[model samples]
Target: MPDRHVTRSGDDYAEALSQLLPQGQAWPRDEGSTLMRVVRGLSQIWGVVEASASKLLEVESDPRITLDLLPDWERNWGLPDPYYQEPLTIGDRQKALVQRMTIEGAQSREFFIGVAAQIGYTITITEYRPFMVGLDRCGDNRVYGDGTNLMYSDTFVRGWLPVYDPQGNPVALDEISEWPNYGLGPDTNRHYWTVHVGTSRLTWFRCGGGGGQTGVDPHLRIGLATDLECLLNRWKPAHTQIIFDYSGLTNGGSMAGTP
Candidate 1:
């Protein structure tokens, strides 16, 4: 009932345990509470607290691994499309794009097209310049081959997390604060997250865009980006993977219950 009483009771129990321990027992032998166990407990709590968070934060493993299936792609399926491609060259460039999915059936008719719409999208650009190279290293007085190889990336992610009000209206529906961050390089920068309302899912895209060289602040173009994300969400009309990438052990170890 009263929070103070509950807290006091917990404290008293802790005190009793403290007294029962020998003069200095090394704090419960935390070797029994290794980092792996902590991760297991965290994973469990995450599942309990979010309930549905598991779909996005799941882990899997397989003993039959092979060279053909070395790097997994299934985990980051919800990530933005551009990240899947090769790293952008210093001078090379590509147009930025966004898309959205609008739900229209009876159950999703209201929120999907209404309040949930208020949450905006984000577009971000990151220009990882080359370290620099000397003239001879530039190439054997080579033909205009690609300039210094650099890690140029751009990303678009949801700036504000989405939420819908009781009256069926989107509160903060149109803002892309920063670029979505998946990972880097080939499997370098890959990250993704999702918000779910029943069976319908709002997937945000993220990746390095090739626009960093030009000094563009993607958030300023939120209006255009929102339009694109909305389109991607609504009518792609294609079968697509819903998860990004997967990593972890399959056998389900016992050390997953520590913290």
Candidate 2:
């Protein structure tokens, strides 16, 4: 006998479409490959829509009504947060500093578009990058060999950030780390999380009065990590550990230090 494929239901078809197009982007952006992936994903969605139409006609259902099966913020259903902010190229550090400070309390949506218009705009501006990337959590079970809990984060260095002055230049200031899981190193099995939210120069540098600016210091890392641990520990299921990988944006460097 030949193998047979089963048809899918409206809900099942939607789930399949989601798994195929998980996240907003497709991998490996080659021209031909990207086209194929998009076509496949679109076809799957169309199938779901067609099946839904058939079901509606059979039952004479109200098309205006919508059904939400998942939780309010489930990974599959919730809208992914926009990460890009307007990019502004400045002549020097001081002007950058002023522009960076201008976006202090701007909400994510009105920012860069409406608010920026209200205020005079000049310096080069690019949309903000993703605030977070590759945020994940792990679990632990003695018998299951998964006895680990961790959180990790990474951010851009001098990347197009939200803060700016009236002149639209980027400030040389740093971000106060507000990641949920702050501190707890890898060795410990109790609880830990690491967050990277600072800027750095790609190559090495030296100042007459100061020391080298290569490695991350203890004070800043500990402060953020500690706060994260405290926040997670409050829950009944305490988080164990987190590892942040900021190397991608920072050119393999840490920004948690006094410059």
Top candidate by lDDT:
2
The regions of model 1 sitting more than 4 angstroms off are: 1-75, 82-107, 114-118, 121-219, 225-259
Q: Give the C-alpha miss distance for residue 249 in model 1, angstroms.
A: 50
Q: Write candidate 1's Cα lDDT for 126-187 as tens digits.
A: 22222123311232211221222321222121232322221212323331122222222333
Q: State TM-scores per candidate.
A: 0.17, 0.15
Cα lDDT of model 2 by residue, 1-259, tens digit: 3223344654455445545644545443343575445655655766776766665544223212212311122233221212212211111112222333343543232342333232221112222222222442332100111222221222323233233322223333332222222223433433333323222222123322122323432222211222222222222123333343233223333222233
Candidate 2, residue 154: lDDT: 29
After TM-score superposition, what is the CA distance of residue 158 in candidate 1 from its true location, in Å? Answer: 44
After superposing candidate 2, which stretches have Cα over 4 Å from the reference?
Answer: 1-92, 107-199, 203-259
| Candidate 2: Cα lDDT at 138 | 31
Query: Which numbered prediction scores highest in TM-score against the true structure?
Result: 1
Q: State the lDDT at 21 in candidate 2.
A: 48
